[model samples]
Target: MKAIQIATYNKNIIRALLGLKTVEKSAGSPGDDEVLVKMHAAPCNPSDIAFIQGTYNIVKSLPAVPGFEGAGTVVETGKNTGHLLGKKVSAFVQRDTDGTWAEFFVVHRDDLIVLKDEMDPDQAACFTVNPFTAYGLMEIALLRESKAVVQNAAGGQVAAFVRLMAAENGMEVINIVRKKESVDVLRQAGARHVLYENDEDFEQQLRGLCAELQATTAFDAVGGPLAGTIFNSLVPDAELVIYGGLSGKPVENLDVMGPIFQNKIISGFNLIDWKNELDAEDFEKISGFLQDKFIGGTYKTKIQGSTTLDKIVKGLRGYIANMSAGKILIRP
Candidate 1:
């Protein structure tokens, strides 16, 4: 088997190297509760970079194989889990152990989600984090039909998912991006309104759009000064859900009057916390919803780039660039 490992921890310092010879090791030789999978594709998400930089909530020991979600085919299974053999599946794994970056990995049979045959491996690899995060945000916020929502980093995969899901639910989406070129990209992806953060009249335009669209809920991933701006532009009694801090900085302070006088609320969300509360049945239900969306062409994953295990450095660097409007995949 082959895998990629971080030689060191530094965001500007690209430390991943490829073609490292390794042996796949599993616990208890695949017990009845486990299955061995030959990983086909895995997406490189922002969390993966944070893991390497030791900034993520879940830190990994050095020389770690770092990937969170991936899709693969079950090649071997314990007697009690034999039913899953030969099935294509996707999963989220523990952080410290050998992850989807390797050619082979093992996950509990219960954790191995059977994906629909029509779902492509690349799409399945990119599925869990962005889609589930978008769903959880909407669920926690108690969004209503016909109400409008706002999202920052609208060019990101998760933001794209939120826009599409909101549209399907009969809600309007006001997407905020930093580049003018992203306007068309997001609009084509179903964003009802697109605003550029770097525009000279950004705040004024956002207020006008919010007033015109009646947008009250804001989903902000780039939490910094941008978050404070988004919070201020909300209608009275609206909510702001902060999910990611891509700015690598803290959210700016806002005047106390907004929340006290306007009756607005601010909340933070973590996908792992939400997943811990769901049982297998609930998980399957969410998976079914995602599967249906995929089948109906309501959900789509853009591929920024794809590479084999040997080209991991290039892949990692590409992800670090943070300009691609899609997920990067690695085949191991």
Candidate 2:
């Protein structure tokens, strides 16, 4: 099989670490509840980089395929999966299985999200990670009855959906970005409260806005001190969900001590872990909800560029340099 495999982990240049090789492997046959999919497209995500660099929560062995999600057609299926044989589907690849970056993939039928025939392959290909994470975390915030939510790295791909959630529910968003230009980007997109971290009054503004809205939950992708800063801004008995460590720093070392005895709770939220908790029907329902948002141009994804199989190294490097540019898709 032709696939981009991670040969080893490079701590310094994690994004640019990969190799294109014609590995001798194949999905021989599906079990009674499995299906074989001929992959159409896959997106290059930060999680893929983390997994290949051996920095993700779950580590893959060396010489393994590295994509996490993609969309494709069910080429063949086991006896129980016969009804799904010709359907278009999106799936998440568990670390142990050969990932979705390849030409073909096989996974349990229950993991598949059957896509509507009119759906674009590109949208479905990149569906699992950002869309699911955004919706799942926002749902948590809504469940907690938060009046507003604050997020670090507000210009991120997944954070866009969070912005949409705020707009739809009339919930205020304390969006913090690093660059001045990003404020305009979100502001033009209907975001009323965008701030820059480099501002002299950044922390003071965050503390004020959070207090005004009485925000009880925060969705954090940028870890480190930023997480602690947001933690301190929330009201008492607030909850913080740290889902990504884009800062490449540890949560324990942050200076803020709000979570110590202020009734602030800090926890982690992984999309894959949340997916694992759902039954097949519930997973499909959530997928359908997101699909409706995408198809309606509400929760849309921006594609910076599409890369072929051999150009994955260049793609990863470009994405790492400018994550806010957009998602880079692998159209093999």
Candidate 3:
């Protein structure tokens, strides 16, 4: 099978070599509890870039295929996993392995989440990461009775998911975006409040927005100087969850006095960590939320582009350029 590999990892000039014609390498026949899937589509996420650069938490061995989450059809299954054969499923696999970027991959039957036939393949490809992260952040930080929450990079797919989820829960969202145009994008997607990060009075405006919304929690994706600004705008005893560092800079120092004196809480989240900590019952609960949203037509994926496996490098470059509003997919 032809696939893409991280040909070189130069911090200054990272390169991916596409059209690597090669035979499929099988790890092993599916265990009794595992299923083999023929991958249909997988998204190129920021984490994929981090993996290639070796800056991500999970380091990849050189010449590895890289992708985090994806959806596919079951081709075969172990005896105990036989019920899953021919079903559509999504998975989160270990990095550097033959990930979703390949023609085929295997996952534990328990780890695979079944998807409905009505769901789009591209949307299903993205089901595991962004949506689940948004859902978990809200579940962990926002109490049911909380009025509102704030988030950075509000225009992103995950943030958009958060905004809609909040609205459905009867909670307001104060979504902050670096670009003015994103304000419109998020507002159309159900954000109750929007702030422009580039505004000269961004700090003042953010505080005013939080005050008006009475926001008690903030989800920060852009972790650099922007994180400090987000920290400053929280209500007393509010919680802030930092999950991404798209800014490529260290998170700014917060005024320690505010958190300590105001009794605010600061923490971080990594979806992989959260998933690892959850038992089967918890996974079912979270998966149920996503499933319900899909049935209700509340969870929609905006596909930026789709291409064949041979064009993987081009897809990665497109994502790196930030040229897509939604996800860039590779169909195998």
Candidate 4:
């Protein structure tokens, strides 16, 4: 089988270690509660980059495949999971086994999300990550009865989903982006409150928006000073949820007084943890709801391009260069 293999971790240059190799891998009958999938498309996410650099939360042995999520057809299913055989599915895997970057993937049945027939293979390739993450974040916002929310990395796919979901529920979004051009891009996308963090008055603008909307919740993907900035700007009793550390820095300049006197809180959101917190039935319900949105064209991941396994390294380099533009999918 042809797979994208990372021979070693390269923090400095990802392409230095990434390559396509033909290996003797068996897609044998899956074990109990597992299924074998013939992968169609897999995406290159920032987490994939982190994994290649050996900085992600989940790490596999050397010379391993690097993708975590993808869409494929179920070729075989284990006992009690035969219902999934021949079904089109989007899978998320974190086991020691090779991942979705290969032509074949073996994952536990629980990690697969059954895709609606109308869902395109490319969109389904990205189904398990950003969409669920946005759903989870909005779940928190809805639970808090927040009228509006703030989020960094406004140009990313998850942020785009968050904005759309918030709008559907009559909630506002204060989007913060590092690049000035992103402000215009998001605004044209119908975002009402987009802020350029590089601007001189970014802090003042954020504070005003948070107060005016009474936005008590914020989702932070870029940590470091931006996390603290968002944390301090929200109204009293607000919660700042940190999910990704794209900035590669720790949260800084957080005002202790807010937590000590103003009822402010800092938290984290992990998609795996969020999913695990729900019962199987509830998870299935949410999955159905999200899939309907995709099938209806209410939600979609922006796709920049697609690549073959042989060109994965080149594709990844392009993706890392302009990440906010769109996703790069690997057609394995």
Most lDDT-accurate candidate: 4
lDDT of each: 0.78, 0.82, 0.77, 0.89
Q: Estimate each model's TM-score.
A: 0.90, 0.93, 0.90, 0.96
Off by over 4 Å in 1: 11-32, 141-146, 188-190
- Give the best candidate by TM-score: 4
Which lDDT value does model 4 have at 7? 71
Supply the TM-score for candidate 2: 0.93
Ranking the candidates on lDDT from highest down gives: 4, 2, 1, 3
Give the clashing pairs for model 1.
none
Residue 173's lDDT within candidate 1 is 82
- Please give the lDDT score at residue 134 for candidate 4: 97
* Steric clash count of candidate 4: 0
lDDT, candidate 2, residue 52?
69
For model 3, what is the alpha-carbon lDDT of residue 237?
80
Residue range 53-162, candidate 4, lDDT tens digits = 77789989887877899999999888878899999999998887788988988889889998889998899999999999999999999999999999999999999999
On lDDT, who's better, 2 or 4?
Answer: 4
Per-residue lDDT of 128 in model 2 = 75
Candidate 4 off by > 4 Å = 15-24
lDDT of 2 at 203: 83
lDDT of 3 by residue, 73-178 (tens): 9998998988898999888876445567788877876567898777777778888888889888888656635688888877788887887778777888888888
